[model samples]
Target: MTVFLIWSCSGKNASEISNETLLIVKKIEKINVLMGSAVGSSGHKPNQYENFEELKKNASKQELITLTNHSNGVVRCYSFWALALSENIDLFSIIKDHINDDTQVKTQFGCSGSTEKVGDFFINLVNPKDEDSDITKLTPDEFNKLDSLLIHKENNLYARYDAIANAVPTAYLYSKVREMVVKHNNQNALITLSKYKNPHDIELILKNRDPDEDGESGYFYTYKAIQNFPDPIFLPFLEKKLNETLDNDRYDGEWLQLYMAIASYKNQKSLELLTIPFTKVKHQDIKKYHIKFVYEAIIVNKSKLYDDLLWKIWQDENIITQEGFEYLLQLNKTKTLELSKKELNSNYQIKNTNTIPKINQSMFSQNLEENMLNFVLLNDKVFAYNVINDKIINTNVNDFEMYCSKILELKDPSFTEILFKRLKNEDNPHVYLQIVETLISFKDESINKRILETRKKNKNMNQDWGSEALDEILKKNKIK
Candidate 1:
């Protein structure tokens, strides 16, 4: 078979290139482009190779052999695997040579020590001897080879983790993994142990509870291990740490770990332990630290016992700030929204009128701005237009619309300047029209004059939508 490589010739069209040449050129280009990207991250673009298996299916034996000698290691590795998958047993010698070659390949998990990974990939392609023999059923020799690879510190971390994690959960493998957990305090090793859930291994994990050499606390690993194992024995240890930390003045980071561990327990006792501090603690600072974990515990357990407690906390004016309100809304949105509506209405006057009433406009404006600021600051769910600051403080479209609705309902002349500024800058014709309608409802002469001027200027530039909307508004009010 002939191989085709794309060259830098100008004025070439698709019709001029042979179908076979185009396919080969595309495959080679893909291999070259993808080989340099870092694995296991966003840099690895998989869509480029979506048709890789299809291309492999159409590859000739000669083409596969030629690819094995390609400069890009990934291309070579893939070509060898494709040949192996097609059951081309006659090419085993050539494949082995490629596998034993010193050329390094950057794989999905980064660079392998040599072509050793391709050899592993070849092993994966071979079927098991029996129905019960899975990929994990490796011979003693194969297991040892993988174990050596796993223990080699210079190997890629993901490669090492994958080797042990995918291996059969044998006694020897479990013991080696436990040693890795203790020595390296690796999160992956601990997770691998959790897969086995060996009782003796739990004690080993507990013994090596200190932070790793990298200063990353082992509590996360412990939390994950307990989640997998679900042993009751660790509860007392977790509770003791929680109590000790709460007693101390300094709220070290370890307390968070302890709370997380206790939450992971997902037991009645753990729920009670989490709830007691949230309910009994009157100190605002202490409650603040523990409330997040308490919320997590409640959500994790799905316990109805904390419903009233959460509601009580939400109603507490001293404690229910923007963050707390948002948390409450997340937990029980229907109830919180109902409560919020009532609270908001009682705190501020909301009127729906077409005309601004002549009732102390200065005092009403001041009160409205102050109330709007308070509402915006206290409730994370509400958006506010700051009249003095001349900015929309929040980006939520629904919240902004609600604030605009309130301004229109009250027919507040104080918001005329900011609203006009926003209307002039807004590119969306529909939203600009709505703002014009709201402005017209205010019935302020100065605002009407400004709108008329803006409409005339827009008309001159052939940007006549604003002028047309303002004309409709003036006609509706029966103004000349």
Candidate 2:
């Protein structure tokens, strides 16, 4: 008891401590001491406690009220639950006022609700009666106060949002919520109104769905609203945008969301519209977007109609990458692999012609040299600077391994500097290890000296995967 008192007093003077503050300090001290005792008894932390009921029963109403305002959010949250269990009416106003505190509190499971807003949690505890019923528990004055807060434009966005969301179950302030949705076109208000299945809210969202002068569009939320309501009336607007995107040869960034919204209908008309863009679009970007969404839609709806279309897309060398092929394989492995074999044989043909095919270079050339080096290393390929073609060509192949095999197969000394540079600056430990392992296979005394120097430089610093990699290489080679 004295240890607890001394620890609490050390932080703040007894003269400055209020009765409310002292109560919280004492409660925390008791909990800590109890935890210590439990640890001592069991030699392990106790998950369940036998004294939890006693602890709650002992809490005074006044002290609980005071604890709600405590600097420690966990203490405040515990006080909230205790007051709720005790059915203390006084807690209502205090909980409502502190709804926006935003202090993180931990659950009984020890995970913190850092991402959750406190106001949302407080509103859930209120549990007002259903929409048609009269306010059963709250006084008329308190009920009116909640209604005012729900539509108060000046209040915190989350606070007002929570009020509207919670008010839905009780149907409290329904008219005011509709009015806010229409008048303000507020995103949160629209979301709430959509939940109630109001047709008018859909029209409002479409009417207000224009991009700003800065080309910033709220179509993401607009698409979300349309998905919630799922009205056929909105299909023309969506189709028109899709057509515009196709015509302009550029994406509006919300293309994926729009495509998904269209596919959500799962109807002949919507499916037909979705297939139009996929079949007719030659633009690789548009093709990629369609492939991704179409595959997702097929998986979601379990539709077999798009199987042939996905296979066709997978065969298109310009549209699919190694990663995309892997993803397609996951969706349907047998069909994907069968298609991939045919496509790979044709695409990877080593031609003697000096004419390089006009492919989209931007995709492969962004990190040109680095990407080329990676291709050569990982794909067991070689590049030659063809002066006539004015492009690099894949010239040879060897077995792919990280260590001795890769180093022994390197016919070009030009790549050695590139490998060393990558090894020196590479931050990823696994990659660093691969490079060190490859360099070790060279068995060059000069390279070994450099490796040892690097080891010495990083030795006194933090031991990471990079340092561990160096140790493995040194151990394997029997080097000091």
Candidate 3:
């Protein structure tokens, strides 16, 4: 679980790399110099943590350059990292050329390899689905180069992979652009790669974005190609592929990409799209795509949207079975809650942290309530929460305890009346415990009622659960 943390250059003094860092770099450089092609283990560098790492923190601009040039591949990788951090535009072309070099080392006389464009490669990795990065930590100049490189052309994966070594955005390297990114400069490269299911080579293209000094993106050709064939076989496969990939951890940013892609889908079909197997997926990120995709479809298809599919999925207990309901609760309140409220049942019980209030106040607040009310629920579930200084806290909300808490919180006597009836009729132990907890939370007054109630609920709850909870609270409060 060792994640690589690379420092990218934006616009800073490349020459200013410090000297203290150079001490370690000098050693690594010597190793590279002495060992040559065999510098790393069997032609590759050792673990990414090269010995030079210790000096990296306080490294000045000059020392950084030396460290970047050290003999090891790990060292060379850091070079890109240092340059990215510098944010100096002048170094970009230089670094770009270095990565663009198709010149492979003479491992065996002359076994040269690809000479792909590195610009597009790096950009693609940063935001695989092309979501913008929060290089805000980067100076203005640093981001400018990234913005400049987003659509730059590249020949193979090396450039992109190396670029990945240079930067790590939260959601870069999207699977959506996997096929397209591989064919950075080649117009019909994607078509060839996908075997013409996506004919015209430039079929589903990104927009006309000129990220280089020339400011000329090949969007027109790609668009014209997609338009060339209104209905292509690849589109269905593309949709299916996206749906299938939702179960994977690799597509961490699938939701963002699809959200953006669907927005641009001038002729997208919601029925077919909604029917896609988002329900069966096991990843949290992928489920998010379903919600996003549906939202986009709703906006575009409107009357044509067959929301019944969503309703069915909403009611499905197993829909979120892949991941836990707690994860579903983590979704942006504005996004899920708003959508949910539109279709959620009255007994919706939230199973996770309600950061929804925070999100509702942010830019995404538009649909807070709508999303919050969407979670599927039952009438008898316990929905109890503890408030410590007005901040609500509910420790256990597994499918076992949500509804009871919700009903217990009601000030009205009618809620209790409903629970009283359900308590007598329902034999589910979890349900009974929930009902009891609500009553206990109710007027901590009624000591006799409380003891009897606690005793009865205790019988139904987990063996030691009620006693343990009371003991812990009493230990803290030291009450009689």
Candidate 4:
């Protein structure tokens, strides 16, 4: 074990450990951080749920693989499950054996969700197999270990929790987790969570503890015992949310605690009530949240149900407004991008050259290029640029640079003219600096004209928007 640990730990700094080991370390360190241990004694104050984030950033691909094979079954199980979350089947050949992709059912969670079964995921990778066995397959014994952890009462809380999550891989897990809450005697814990005033918590309590069920006090009492222990009882809560998004049914989970109470307890009829007032939800912000999840619930239909909300939002004088665009951007990027494309293209159906809404088309045309660019800008770019660490920042800075370069590559006469116009006086140093940085990514000297013009403007103005903004832009441009 010592030799193997040393071998896996080689070819790495404390900074560059593989993701598998890093995840294991993260799990252990999270416990340490929670326990206020000396292990993370660098004066770092761990955020409630964020302590493992940095270790996740520093972990490598192979280290994650190694951690999956850790000597401790608990460690192996934890890392095995993490891979299911972070990776698709393609990341490692081993996943292919568990997930056949052809035989799985279309669960409420996603399309062909059966083929991407979480049970198959953990079952295949949990304990691995004979030294001579194929990488794509695992033995029956290996699969059982994962199952036993969930169905068997002997396994610890973490193992049972992760196992059940792997087992159902659906809103069905809600029932299983509820069962576990009882098995684990978590009632007092649950009651405490319910008493909390926050909506997200009250939402969670009402979600996991259904009011309609009478005998649940037994289960509730069990859960209350572990209230202060800080187990992630929210797992099934998150799963219920993602799964109830199956369709634009009357009772998808989007209406807060409504879906949890229904789906977690097998009240299939609740789906009907799930979607009431969607069309009638007139408040822009509330309507936006409804449509965001409603769209997900109806994603299987492509745009059949989406068209309803889209048309209503687009046509309603009261509903269709900029306030909802933020919510729309959060739902499905593919659908939103497609909608933007359609609205931009002359041949596309939704375009309104009539200028009915009086959108800011002249300042920035809603062409595909500009719309997509603005979506990224208004959505994630602010957070990405501000995040100093790789974990929160996403690992693809260069890819983002390339993607932004593609936006700059658009040669539309209007778009190009606007680039030069904005570069000359763009007050947002961050946005302007991003433009300069992205322009150079294309490596085309033709853009040099734009840069030169901006520099000329930068010199003559004798400093406009404070020296800090100038300093920022120059820093991004690496200007002398």
Provide the TM-score for each candidate, comma-separated. 0.44, 0.44, 0.40, 0.36
Tens digits of per-residue lDDT for model 2, 1-480 = 221122211133222334444554555534432221144333544432323333456656655565556555555555565566665356458646764566443333222113334444454444454342422245556655765664653554365765565455336655666777676666566656666666755677677553442343457657666666668888988787666666445555576667767776767777777777766776867666665665555444444555455556556533454544445545654444334334433435433333322222232433323232333333233322111011111211121222223344554444455556544544556555655666767777777777666655544212676676667778889776
Tens digits of lDDT, candidate 1, 176-271: 777777777766778678778777776865665546533334465666566566678878766755565454443445445566667666667876
What does the lDDT read for residue 273 in candidate 2?
Answer: 72
List model 3 lDDT by residue over 239-280, tens digit each: 644555556654433343343333333444525554554556
Give the CA lDDT, 0 to 100, for residue 297 in model 2.
51
Top candidate when judged by lDDT against the true structure: 1
| Cα-based lDDT at residue 1, candidate 2 | 22
Displacement of the residue 451 alpha carbon in candidate 1, Å: 8.1
Q: List the residue pairs that clash in candidate 1.
A: none
For residues 1-480, what per-residue lDDT tens digits would candidate 4 score against the true structure? 122242222224222344454444646534432211122436343352243344345445555556544433333333444454464333344432223222221221111112223334354443445342323334465455445444544432333444443453334334444444445534333443333323444434534543434421223322332222223454454344434333433432324332233223222233333344454554555555665443333332233334445444433322333434434545544455435544323244443342222123332333434444444344444322232122112324343343344455542232343445545765544445555655555555666556756766765333556445645655665654
| Per-model CA lDDT versus the true structure | 0.54, 0.52, 0.40, 0.40
Better model by lDDT: candidate 2 vs candidate 3: 2
TM-score of 3: 0.40
Flag regions of model 4 displaced more than 4 Å: 1-144, 168-275, 279-287, 300-404, 411-416, 427-430, 433-450, 459-480
Cα lDDT of model 2 overall? 0.52
